[model samples]
Target: MTQDLFDPFAPVPETPAKSGNTPEFSVSDLSNALKNTVEDAFSFVRVRGEISGFKRASSGHMYLALKDDKAVLDGVCWRGQAGKLGLVPEDGMEVIVTGRLTTFPGRSKYQIVIETMEVAGEGALLKLLEERKKKLAGEGLFDADRKKPIPFLPDVIGIVTSPTGAVIRDIMHRLRDRFPRRVLLWPVLVQGNGAAEQVAEAVRGFNDLLPYGHIPRPDVLIVARGGGSLEDLWAFNEEVVARAVAESDIPVISAVGHETDTTLIDFVSDLRAPTPTGAAEKAVPVRGDLIGQIEENGLRLSQAVRRLGVEKKTALESLARGLGDPKRMLEERNQMLDNWADRLPRSAVNVVSQARARLNETSARLVSPREQLSEKRGRLENAAVRLDGAMKSALQMQQARLDRASAGLRPSDAKRDVDRAGKQIMDLGARMGAAVKNTLTREAEGLARYDRLLESYSYRNVLKRGFAVVRDGAGNLVEKSADIVTGQGYDLEMGDGVTRVTAGDATTEPASTPTAPTSGGARDGDDMPVDAVASSKPETVSKPKAVKKKDPQPKDDDRQGSLL
Candidate 1:
């Protein structure tokens, strides 16, 4: 029994085999068969699923996996078809794809060859839009600080919209109504199939225009389109379009769809208009209103200037009132000139007398020329005697030295030394004479200056300027009005001659003040005759009151007065 136990590796006895009819297939042939079957069965199908593992190849083909929770079906969108699909497919996007089912023999896999694709529903489109917004916002593309300010008045306006749509017509009509401006139309597809790419390219093209070239660069850009559904307006919401709007150097005004409709470009643009017409309104101001405002401002400025002039004139008039009468001021200045004139003659006489006294004193201190010459002659005689004695002694010493040095001494050298000494003496005498002449000339110039100064200080100059001196009976100056006594005789010293006149009684009180009337005379403020007033005070003479004088020719109020 142990020997008969299982032999695991032993060969078993063979039996005759019978075969039935069945089909055989290679890997290539089987894969081809299945592909054809799938193509025929689901040739035109719309499959709804969330996209996964989405990839765009360099060959311009898109490969993606369409997946629900339970299963995934591979899908491919050729380059030509992918662009026709309005929206780009992204991972996690719920989409409906219309295509034929096919199999790849190389990988032995089945896939959907996508002809067209779209967001599965409104909810899916909104979700995709929101997700993309969040992603771009996180990158700071929607930041308010990144947005440029719109120009109040743009020179050239660039519009990106469909060429034949009512949106452009509406914008142009609105602009014409408000203000006329140069409009550059960058025609683009506003919706469907490659619309987003066209919009992006149009924006970039407008920005690329040279500012000072054949084409004028736009100061502002308007991306406008008519009202439509979210899907129809999705071209403006694409990330490519949004990014182009954000990076534009010119300010962008987004006006897409209706007022309630929103897009990603609207967030990144400098301004968002509710409608295409609204965008035009934002681009320029009402011309008539601007002209009216300018005219109003000009009127206001003129009024302000006139008012300022009136105020300054009033201020000047008030200041002029504070200044005393100009005639009285001139009289006072003339009196001052008279006083200066009276002192000038005396000052000049004193200066001349002092200078003359100094000259006499200096002359008294000087020695006589004859005595000076005699003293100098005695000194010269003494010097000559000393020289004679010194010369004799020096000659004796030289004779002793000559006995030893005459062997090498030259008579020609001695003669040359003597000639040089004589030449030096002549030069010194000439210089001394020139120095004395210069000193005399300087002293004469100084004397001339003093003489001119004395003449300048003379009172005759003051008299020539129409000033006169007033002196009392005692020949003392009556320098002020208070110094003149009633019935006193005084001398008026003019430049040519002097006249004597008795001073009349002077008024002590101001003209504006009232004085008590004399006994049996008219009361104050009474306009009585001058002769009658004099007759009333027969014993005592009454001086006329000094009235404040008014300007005879008043200055024009419009003329600017001198500050001085």
Candidate 2:
């Protein structure tokens, strides 16, 4: 007997056949045969081992190896079955998988095709739960600060639980007995496959409802379940359900299982209740007690207000008594006023008598106005006579001096001086006229030179040389052929006149015939046609007549003569 060295468990080969009776098999045929044999033999199995090399592919397929102290077995769970496995598979986690054994033809190896997988036992499940709790706690999901305060009295209370269970009924009955509220029941599976997902979705669904929508959104959420074993209540222990509770916008009251039954959700929820009934009680207060307290407070407030009003009235009355009588004071003031009025008229008559006597005495001591004026006129006549005598003496002295001075002069001397002044005036006027004539002549010559220079620089001189200035219809100078637009009108300015033309095909006729220069006598420089000058014979060309320059001589007119 010989065993294959590569595979210790492989079947041993029998003795060599004498004839060619041994059947030959290809690699694929052998692999398929082994796959069929392994599937048929272990069609259903449950394997218990520690997970190793666990990896989830991007395609959602999970690949891993299960190993014990002695040997290792490879396993694979397709995407469809992986989600239903309840717990996430991790490295070093002890698990139990149920599936069929199959062989891979390409690799020529045997593996288990897992359908369902779970933590191996209660102890293993507890270990996995503890590890998950530590991970979520590290991320602050279980912190007290992250938990929201539950509403004391919610208008709408949303509950997530199985519809057919007795747990929901107990909660509803308790709420009705205490303070009846509007309840929104979100039906979900409590335990089994997909139970965790349903519970998580129910929590998120209530939060998604709009506050002002047709259906009233709940103010608080209650997640309740009945008492059960650890395995039976495993759904609440799921990490997904715990995260959903932690992230809830509304406060949550966890009432899953009994008082002693703890799960991941209990640690994350805002509040925890021992039972479903307890959760309902925590949701709202008793209506009767609230009403009784309010009435008691109102009674106390009214009594305090009444007592304050009595104290204020007593204070006001005491202050009024301290004031004295107002009528007595007014009577005393009236008596004093009558005494002063009786004495005032007698004092006025005495003052008038004294003033009249003083006026009579002053008149007796003064002189009359008519007598004083007569004395002043007499003094004025005396001064006028003395002044007339002095004036006549001064006039006689002045007249004697004038007669002595006239005796030393002669009329011939006076006449000679007058004639000499008249001759000097005539000579000055003649010299002034000559100077003005010279200045006028120089100014006129300068003006004529400027006129000639301006004519030399004028464009008309170029026209006299047989050139014409062209301009567009808009009157802009056309210096280049590129500036001319086809089919546009143009003007040709010659020395004589401006002629209009149109730019068209090369063979097109002019728009208007240029008018022939008038056949009159030779014109002056200002109006002569340059074309006629250029066409004439050189010998017959007459020099342009000189422009008459204006004399700048000053004009004589009736005006004021110079004082000099």
Candidate 3:
């Protein structure tokens, strides 16, 4: 396999320095010498193109490449000048690169030591992410302290995903098979260009509801999709999504793509799941174990109840055995009863006299309540009559007004007015058509401008600069430095996904790099499962069945690298 000219890991592979065969020394040594001389001569050089494979290095530097369709230049930014870059770079994006062209004498490779990088798409989403990071970081949303804990026993769980995908189905299935608790779903796009924004909105929507709304607030939010290439999953990397996840009052679980793929949301989320199915598992309570435990607890309770009954019976028997004889106790009780019975007649006489007086008092009091009740009834009847009269009067007034209005408008005049209005309406309709056409024209121009901006400074331009994309199994773009945790695996879409690659960047960013499809931690293999987000997963789930499935699709499915 051919080695990468800028493989940071490999011993700088030997480059055949001087082209052509006729050489006194080997081409490798000549190439090395030429590389050194050129690098030494021009301490700096400036190039214009798009940015690709933009990455931040551990040494407080930036590493990326610049390119257009025709050519690409490997580049780097040192610690000092990297801070000066006014714009954050993105793959396939166009930009102006200013740097010192030099050769690493050790590797005999040519590269640019970057100074200033500016996007003709300047201050776009990448810059927006940096700004957002600062903003949210300031708000403690990204802080470890403020993150909500995922519910251990969520009474109800809400899922956000595409309605047709396996994500919802899987979630429903798992939830049913397990605890069979309530599983609520809010369907949304999990992939594609709009998926991130939709996902973010759905998350916010759940939080926005009052108690009596259609869907309950999710105890844990699961954003999910199947597996795909990095570009395919770019929607999850959007900063809007990342911030939404970070700022969510409910803990979020990211389940985009396969195990290897992770997005910005992963870093900001409470948890990261490998797949939609996995996300379902994470959000759901384990059914089998929970039910078994419940049953076990029930049995234990029954036993405890029996034991308590036995203990109570034994105590009652002991008290009964310790008690005095029934005959002696009966005699004492009879004597006490006789004395009280004799006094009872006198007490009864006094009580009877007092009761008689109270009865007379109660009879007198009854007259006022009866009279008051009658008066209230009379008032209610009067109120009803008044209400009826008011309603009739109002109805009559409205009828009179309508009659007057109609009377004033003679039929001829009304018809004439209607005709005039018709003519005016037609004229307005024609004008509205013209306005629509003009609006479309303006919008078309705006779209063209947007395309130009993209061409001048988007991820595509960056890729031309010899950068590569590392996608998770589900094809989501993982941009955050924090997302690429150890043990995470991914599929790389190099310049064309056509160009072969031999290595990956030694991920150094803080895993907060915001991109289109942001997410949480890494999971398992690149299993292109269906969306389980919208589907249900009760504890009674079946095994992974043999089911037909469409391959996971990317945002720009029709993309073939065309200029706008």
The model with the greater TM-score, 1 or 2, is: 2
Distance from true location, Cα of 522 in model 2, Å: 89
Better of 2 and 3 by TM-score: 2
Q: 1-564, model 2: which lDDT tens digit per residue?
A: 112222445433355545695545556655766776688778999999999999999999999999999999999999999887877789999988999999889987889999888778999889888998999999999998988888878999999999987999999999988899999999998987788989999999999999757878899999999999888898999989999999899999999999999999999999999999999998989888888888888987887888788877887777765665567667777777777777778878877877777888887889988888988887888888988988998899899889888997899999999999999988998898888888888988898898887566555553444345567777766755556566777776655666676655432332321212222222334344455444432312231211110111112111101100
Query: Model 1, 484-561: lDDT tens per residue?
Result: 665667666544666676655335433212212212233232242345334434422243422111111112222112
What is the lDDT of every predicted structure here? 0.79, 0.77, 0.65
Worst 10 residues of 1 by lDDT: 545-554
Whole-model alpha-carbon lDDT for candidate 3: 0.65
RMSD of each: 49.7, 21.3, 63.2
lDDT pick, better of 1 and 2: 1
User: Which rank order by lDDT, best down to worst?
Assistant: 1, 2, 3
RMSD of 3: 63.2
User: What 10-residue stretch in candidate 3 is worst by lDDT?
Assistant: 539-548
User: How does model 2 fare in lDDT?
Assistant: 0.77
